[model samples]
Target: MSHSVVVGIDGSAQSRAAAEWAATEACRSGRRLRLVHVGAAENGTRAQPESAEDCLPPSVLSVRDRIAAALPGLELSCVRMGGSPPYALAAAGEREGLLVLGSRGLGGFTGMLVGSVGLHVAAHALCPVVLVRADPDGGAGAAGDVVVGVDGDRLGDEVLAFAFEQAACRGATLRAVESRALPTGPYVTRAPLDQCEIRDSLAEAELVRLQDALACWHDKFPEVRVETEITAHPAGRALVEASRAASLVVVGRRTPALRAAVHRLGTVAHAVLHHAHSPVAVVPHD
Candidate 1:
């Protein structure tokens, strides 16, 4: 199987982290690493802006060189193009490559927040997009686990399967979480439960259902150590909180079937990408 990991870098510490993460992944997978930094020209217009000819920041190039040097055997290349990071990265992803990027950039102020590039790429990229957050604790160890959330959606299997493979490769534990929460719309019955006790009972039933679903996966991946968690909050929030201990958080993207009635991302997925303490993998629905 052929694979390539393309990372977006802007020369800041945050982007440097993203580059390092991407390079490490490439080395592990024995895939080439394409380190891309969007200069002003390759952005939206596609026209080479005269003034932006030498715009690729020297700091960014230096960072890329250092990372490439650190990883002697890794194949790394840095490109300076004009355009937005998200669009450029997405275009690269369309060729069936993984796109990795930092959640923020050089201006420490904005780096504290998830930038539009990370969000846009996560939502629209064709291949899996890994959005790395700035973590003071540094990167995951060889034994760190890759945790994933599953909800039986189109992309659920993709996320779980990918995480399983990654965990196996890294010799890390594999954990899966399924959330139990009432859907936004009411159940089939129009009759409302008048008593609070009745509502509480229904909630309990839902929790049991979620457990059953998780148990099914446990039976399937018996060799892959699995730990399950249940929470009552929104799916995204629950997953984001859990991400603190995870090396990577994996979630399914919106499938075509659900796109008509809803946007690709719900509130939770958005929150997870913006606030997750670890890197997030947005896997497209298969």
Candidate 2:
């Protein structure tokens, strides 16, 4: 918890919002805050004399200043570096507990706010990467609940661990949503009489599985309240809907080889990353 929360900064509104979110998180976790700026594009020429902050808008600089002054007791510092933004951030986060970033950074093509930088960092970071885009309301940390996506997938435990810990830290309710799809045409040859019954049975079994997975966690954090949901909807759509009211959405990143081959995440996590209103944490697991 004492490890620093590293946030990427660029001259963009979304990046500023991320910094604000990271500041609140650092305050809550009793961790230091590091504001990092990667001056130039990975392949582009470097900017002149001053640091990346000099190239940022005055409003962005003011946001950093305001946060520092407002949270005087919180340990905060800023650093300037140059390289590929994604690589630099991932490297910095190797030792840090979390890497926080804007859903969208500066300098992408039209209609694309979350440029290559955000995507690459999410895909490759050594630690968990959180993407934040604040709303007109009080932003993410005020949403009062943590929503996590759970399935019979490989990395679900890692995601659950993060969700429970975060809920414990915020004293918020933890909502675990499990989205299961029914068996397909060819696979259902033996079960013709009761497709609906089979689906219902599977759903009940999944709920039991989810509960069993969390049993120890429930004991570990007795103060945290947990609510469960089992839906017939697709994972991505289900999580997007849940995210509308969630403070944080937790999902898992696939292993390195799979990530490289599949372009970082599965369909559900990718969809939640783009559509979730809350800050989404991509926790990497084997």
Candidate 3:
């Protein structure tokens, strides 16, 4: 099935960046773009109109106009809804396809890596979501490459395919991070890392295991350039840290309990969504 992209706009500089990215994606994929703007946050009551300036938020309207003008050839439609940004975006994406949002909005703190709305959509959106965060001057396009985190588990196969597809579409490099651990404590108490990884260290046996696991992907997408990194640390922290220079960080959610836990307590995926300097892409492993 084909997929269109729905973008959340608020006229914030960050939102504009997101819209631009979405427009680019839409144009490239020959898909449609839906621009959705949520009304000003209030006490669930409509605001009385005083002047034209106060009637609508400038950032919201400005982004709407800019995206419309920028992608005149693409199928673009705009919406002005009254509610929270995440809710509006989620509803819009329910039919169109993927949901896209900025890393931060006008209400966001300058120091925060990701905004509240981004966190909400990334956690709850029914479809895949992309959180855009790049300098307005266009540093994002040049950030170069998509980095995806994976453990040598059942989930890695699907995640590997998704990451490779995204990278191929974006003309970007793909980096797969297989996270393991190091034996730090005594051997008596040494055990598995809570079913996360079966063993510790990236020894010869571990490399062979990982290579064997990746044989399918290697055969399927032989032309797609990929780099593999075997990390010895916690998965969440390592992936989030790697997102600093990455254009997008891809992570997969597996199992119902794991999904709920990630959404609630911020798993490796959510932590990357909230803390990554770049945008994050969370995909389901099912």
Best by TM-score: 2
> What tens-digit string does per-residue lDDT give for candidate 1 at 1-286?
3467888888766677788888888888889988777765433345342233244567776877788689878877767655666677788766646888887865446434577677778877767888776567654322256778767333366667678767766766777676765554433554665555565667677656655665655566666676665566777877878877778888878656644444366566787877777888888764
- In angstroms, the error of model 2 at 83 is 1.1
Put down candidate 3 lDDT per residue, 1-286, tens digits, no spaces.
3467888877777777888888887887788877776775333456332112234566666766776786678888665666566776777776676777888887888678688887777666656678888674853443667888877766455567767777877777788777876555444435645432434432556667777776677677776677777778677788877887677888876535454454432377767776776777766555
Name the better of 1 and 2 by TM-score.
Answer: 2
State each model's C-alpha RMSD to the native: 6.0, 4.4, 6.4
Q: What is the C-alpha lDDT of each candidate?
A: 0.70, 0.78, 0.70
Query: How should the candidates be ordered by lDDT, best one leading?
Result: 2, 3, 1
Every model's TM-score: 0.76, 0.84, 0.78
Best by lDDT: 2
Backbone clash pairs for candidate 3 read 10-59, 10-60, 11-59
Rank all candidate structures by their TM-score, best first, as comma-separated numbers: 2, 3, 1
Clashes (backbone N, CA, C under 3 Å), per candidate, total 7, 0, 3
In candidate 3 the C-alpha lDDT for residue 7 amounts to: 83
